[model samples]
Target: MSKFKKKAEVKQEIPTSSMPDVVFMLLFFFMVTTEMRKSSIEVKQQIPKAAQLRKLERKTLVANLYIGQPTEAKFGTEEKIQANDAFISTEDIIRWVNEEKSKLAEAEREQLTIAIKGDKDAKRGIIADVETELRKGNARKVLYTAADNSNARKN
Candidate 1:
């Protein structure tokens, strides 16, 4: 009984609900807006080992070619050609290399590198063709695709 009831009165109100709904809405929003990562292509080729394998950070061009033994269909069966018959066409190589070179020129990008992905069973001559085309395109750096250790052990 001091002058006017001393301290009036202190009141506190607890939240009834709605907090769970708010949290659920926020979680759903984030889940809906989240971005899904794209899948990367598998590198399918055999690379020759080197004592010094330097890693390159940037790749300006990627050339994909399918080189394999020619198959001839006979009596509903596929007949594989001999080793000497395996080859990649020269015209195709030239076209792909030129395309990559033009891409670099159009983008005005420097420090261009060429990445060649070829079939593992492809002949050396086919790889040589790719290299020659790259040289003509004036590509200074080159990277070759290779099979992983597990895949190598399988073969």
Candidate 2:
């Protein structure tokens, strides 16, 4: 009869002491892996398609220049040049380039690159003007951004 009687069983519980550490590790991983652009683009740009494109290795050394028409009606449909968050005139390009260049270390100034992202339908003269300004500013390291054309290669 005594052997037939069963002993009380202890319930096992999960240890949650390491749960917050695991959650924080995941948060830190996402924070470091995700890319967040510092500047907001106000213009609408439909970049031209090209067969070749290269990704910039360091984002901090790159300055983005956007050329396209205003997205809002109040700003008009005329094409404009956007540097960082502001709509800059062609004349401002040189000053903007110099400012961006100055932000980098002297040794890294030569490594700084300007990424020009222009709309497919934007005026060619505008692009030429920007390029001229870049050369004048001695910031000649320029990269033109374009969409990858997958079909072009196949055809």
- Maximum-TM-score candidate: 2
Clashing pairs in 1: none
Return the TM-score for candidate 2, rounded to 2 decimals: 0.75
Instruction: Give residue 17's lDDT in candidate 1 (0 to 100).
Output: 96
Best by lDDT: 2
Tell me the tens digit of each residue's lDDT in model 1 across 102-153. Answer: 7676664335665555555566776686677667766646676554465435
Task: State residue 96's C-alpha deviation in candidate 2, in Å.
Answer: 0.7
RMSD of model 1 against the true structure: 12.8
> Against the true structure, what is each candidate's TM-score?
0.43, 0.75
